[model samples]
Target: MQITASTVSLTVDDVAASQRFFTTHLGYVEQAAAEGFASLARSDAALDVVLLARGTEVLPADQRDRHASGLILAFTATGIEAEEERLRAEGVEITMPLREEPWGERLFQVTDPNGVIVQFVEWVTPSAPANA
Candidate 1:
């Protein structure tokens, strides 16, 4: 089947807080919103985001109170260093400092007001070993 688009739904304690964070810091635009729900999208190819407040009735009985945890919403990005710097200049707390792995993965992380972890990554050619 062809998937036309993608979205990630997150249940958070404060939907508005998460909403503001995504829109203000991540460039997402609000598509729709209600008392406890919000749909956000970006003009680019990035996946959409749906924020649902904890205990929202639309969720199943067992899942209503469950908040998003142990998840990191990662996006492949470019100019990661400048992005990190821009975020820093905007007063965003960088939870994970930018670092490059030996395999050529460069990444950093930030946590929104609702404690949602967002990460941006860039890839480049790995540096050759000094001995090689």
Candidate 2:
């Protein structure tokens, strides 16, 4: 099947809070919104996000009471250090400090108002293997 786009729908206690966090800090624009839902899009990327308020009718009755948890929404990025600095300058708290791994992944994270962990990662050349 050919996929035209990708979207992640999150059920949160406060849809507006997550919406604002994404738009204000992550360059997303509101595609649509209502009392209990919001759709966001970015012109530079295919990532689309939908926020549904807990207990909203849009969710199945059994799922309405559940909230999104234990999830990390990540973006593969370039110039991760610069982005981290920019976010810091904007007063966004960095929940995870910028760090690089041995296998060549650089990343950091920030928690949104509703506790969604937004992580940015950059892939780099790995260091020489210890046995190499």
Best by TM-score: 1
Q: Choose the strongest candidate by lDDT.
A: 1
> Please, what are the lDDT tens digits per residue for candidate 1 over residues 32-90?
99999999999999999999999988999999998898999999999999999999999
Backbone clashes in model 2, listed as residue pairs = none
Query: TM-scores of the models, in the given order?
Result: 0.98, 0.95
List runs of model 1 lying over 4 Å from the truth: none
- Mark the regions of model 2 whose C-alpha exceeds 4 Å error after superposition: 129-132
Model 2 agreement with the true structure over 13-65: per-residue lDDT tens digits:
99999999999999999999999999999997757999999999877899998
Model 2's TM-score against the true structure = 0.95
Distance (Å) between predicted and true CA of 95, model 1? 0.3
Worst 10 residues of 2 by lDDT: 43-52
Q: Give the TM-score (vs. native) of candidate 1.
A: 0.98
